[model samples]
Target: MHVPDGFIDAPVSVAAGVVAAGAVAVSLRGARRELGGERAGPIGGERTAPLAGLVAAFVFAVQMLNFPVAAGTSGHLLGGALAAILVGPYTGVLCVSVVLLMQGVLFADGGLTALGVNIVLMGIVTVLVAWGVFRGLTALLPRTRRSVVVASFVAALLSVPASAAAFVLLYALGGVTEVPLGSVLAAMVGVHVLIGIGEALITALTVSAVLAVRPDLVYGARGLAAPLKLRVGGELVDAPAAEPAPAPARSPRRVWIGGLVASLVLAGFVSFYASANPDGLERVASDKGFDKSVEEHHTADSPLADYGVADITNARLSGGLAGVIGVGATVVVGTGVFYAVRRRRTGSGDGAGSTGGGDRDTAGSSA
Candidate 1:
């Protein structure tokens, strides 16, 4: 949920800003390693940066399609679970953060003053909880593509309520007005629980689709979907495989173009059919009588406020143009950030004069 200014007191907002900043810093470092992409070698492939960028853009685009969750409440993709399953947890945090940044600065959807709150509640908390649950569930379940999808569903389902609880705790600490903490907690959790179901379904479906097409690109499926080997004389034997050409099939261009087209379709056209009801947090805040505390966004006068371009009177065209612009900007920024991280990782490895993981790992590197 996009928390506006004045919903959270200044002290608590600043505290969250500090926490968010620290978390982002940590995530950036972790992303370097997670995205330490192998240079194109005998088993030719593309770097991880572009895929990570697409994750950010895709999250931004899907979030625009708010589905009805209750009578007056709708829910959009939080995307932590989806991104973490597709990319990695470290990169996933950055993806959501990038969307928040774009929305706050350009679209006036989230307030600049409350950016930290949104980042902490929606980005960091969701990613941490979802990723933790995913890893734990995957460890317990059978190692297969189906298991990965199941784990994604469970993790995403739990993450929504966990984020709601975090918001309640923060509000309790720095609520500007007198509100019943218990009531707020109950309403927030109740509405968000419904939203969590939607999150789980979307996360599972997206993860399953990606796994089917390009399992190697899914970070969570790494080491889980290895090709089965033969058992000979009570010993496991590696199956012989054909050598790939110099230019491997793991070309980023195909996936990138496909993802870009899908994002365009979803944001430009499909979003027009999404429910127009208030999202879960907004509904809960209104019902709980705390919505009056929200301050007008500072960027309310921006051309792209509320996901529609200003001065474009046509509802469909205005919204569609804004959505396309948002996707383009997000991809550019996300790719730049990830590309830098990947370069730093590669540079570090070169300086250290170390070959990455040994032969076994490198040989299996498919996208």
Candidate 2:
């Protein structure tokens, strides 16, 4: 959930900002390992690094659909579970962080002042808990696609309330106004528990869909699924190994294009039907009387504020344009960040500048 401005005091917000910055720094380094070196396969490009950007755009799209969870409360995709299951944990953190950044700076969904709080709660805590639980369950369960999907479900189910609890803990330390802490905790946890069910369903479904198409690209399923076995005279034997890596079932470019199309459709059109109700956190705040302290966003007047373009009286057109713009922006920015991280893993980044300069000097001397 987006923590608007003034929900947390300046000091606590600043502290959260520092924590967020440190976590992002650590995640970036960690992500390099997950996205490291891929000699182009049939796709003929970096394997998982580019997928990070697609995942971010997909998360941004799905989050626009706020399904109703209760009478007057709706909940959207936190996406931590989905991202972690599809990509590695560190990369998952980066994915969600990118979405948060885009939403804050462009769409004005989350306040810039509370960006750190949102990232800590929605990105870091959720990814940590979801990945941990998913890994634990995967280890104990059978090595099959079913197990991965099951673990995704259970992990997603737990992550939402975990995030809510984290927010409560943060609020306890630096809430802008006094509301009954006990009541706030109970309300947030209770509502988010229901939201978690929806989260689990969405995460499981998406993970299953991806696994069916490209299990190799799925980080969590890398070693979890077993190879095919053949029955040889009543005995099961491992299938023959490939000389090189098994080829992808489909083209990576095709998958990327298909995913992008889906994201665009969902955000641009499906989001129009998303319930116009406060989410779990906002509901809790309003119910608890602490919402009065909530301040207007600095970017409230931005063209994309509240997910609509400025001076655009047509709801559908404005929202659709905004969603399309958001998806495009997220893909560009996320791809740039992931590409930089991936390049750093090549270990040639530090010397590239010097190498280029030397070549230029040599050319000049010859001339």
Candidate 3:
């Protein structure tokens, strides 16, 4: 959730800023590995990098559709599950970061001052929890395509509440208001549980659909292959062999474009149906009396407030235009970040290869 300013005290917010910065630093390095070398490169380049932007836009759109969970509380797509499924973990973090930044600047959805905290809670925490649980479940279950989907469901389901708990801890440590800690914790975790179910279902379905079409594109599905079998005395005997690498599927450019279109349509057309109720966090804040100190967004007058163009009388057209602009902005920012990471990875790989080659040549000459 996009935590506005004053929800958390200044000192904790600044601490979160440091944590967020550190996480991004780690993600950049991790992304280089995920996107680097011949092992994962080709896919990382045409598919992963471009699709990263699309993931951000998709996350942005999905977030707008906050489904009601309780009478006063609702939940929206956190994008952590979706992003991790579509892209590698490191890039997934970056994707959400892009969305958060855009929301803060363009829509004034979250406070710029609290950007770091939002990133840590929503971006880093979600990715870590989702990926960790997804991997653990897949490893323990029967190795089948269905296992991946199931793992996705469980992982996503757990991630939301985990994030809520994180926020609760932060507030407990540095809450600005004197709200009852127990009440805040219970309310947040309780409603977010329902939202987590929605998150799990959405993550499972989306991940499964993509896996069916292009399993190669999924980072978590890498190296998962059906077990080998052999005929022995007219009966099949189980044997194990390294799984053959998957072939490249459709060009990433195509996937990226298609995903962007889907995101635009969803935000532009479908988001109007999103629940009007406050999300789980907002509801908790309001009910718990912590919402009183909440300040107005600095960009409240932005043209895209509530996702519509300024001075546009036509609700449908204005909202649509705003959605499209958001998608475009997110894509531009996300792609730029990923492209730079890809280049750095490429450069590092080239340097390593050259060093190895030079060492070999020197040894040969001496011999």
Q: Evaluated with lDDT, which candidate comes out highest?
A: 2
Residue pairs in clash, model 2: none
Instruction: State each model's CA lDDT, in order.
Output: 0.85, 0.85, 0.80
TM-score of 1: 0.89
Instruction: By TM-score, rank the candidates, best first.
Output: 3, 1, 2
Which candidate, 1 or 3, would have the higher TM-score against the true structure?
3
Candidate 2 wrongly placed segments (more than 4 Å): 37-45, 227-250, 349-367
lDDT by residue (1-367, candidate 3, tens digit) is: 7899888889999999999998888888777556553435335353456677778888888888889888867899897977886677888898899999999999888887789889988998899999999888888988888998999999999999989999999988888899888878888888888999999888888888778776777778876776688999999988866675865445666656677888888888888778889898888888889989788888889989878899999987887788888988888888788778866655444334433332232222211
lDDT of 1 by residue, 7-98 (tens): 89999999999999999998887776577634322222226778888999999999999999888789998898898878889889998999
Misplaced by over 4 Å in model 1 are 37-46, 226-249, 350-367
Write candidate 2's Cα lDDT for 170-275 as tens digits.
Answer: 9999998988899999999999999999999999999898889877667898766476899999999999975866665455666778889999999999999999
Residue 9, candidate 3: C-alpha displacement in angstroms: 1.1
Worst 10-residue lDDT window for candidate 1 reads: 37-46
Model 3 scores a TM of 0.91
Q: For model 2, what is the alpha-carbon lDDT of residue 365?
A: 25
The number of the candidate with the highest TM-score is 3
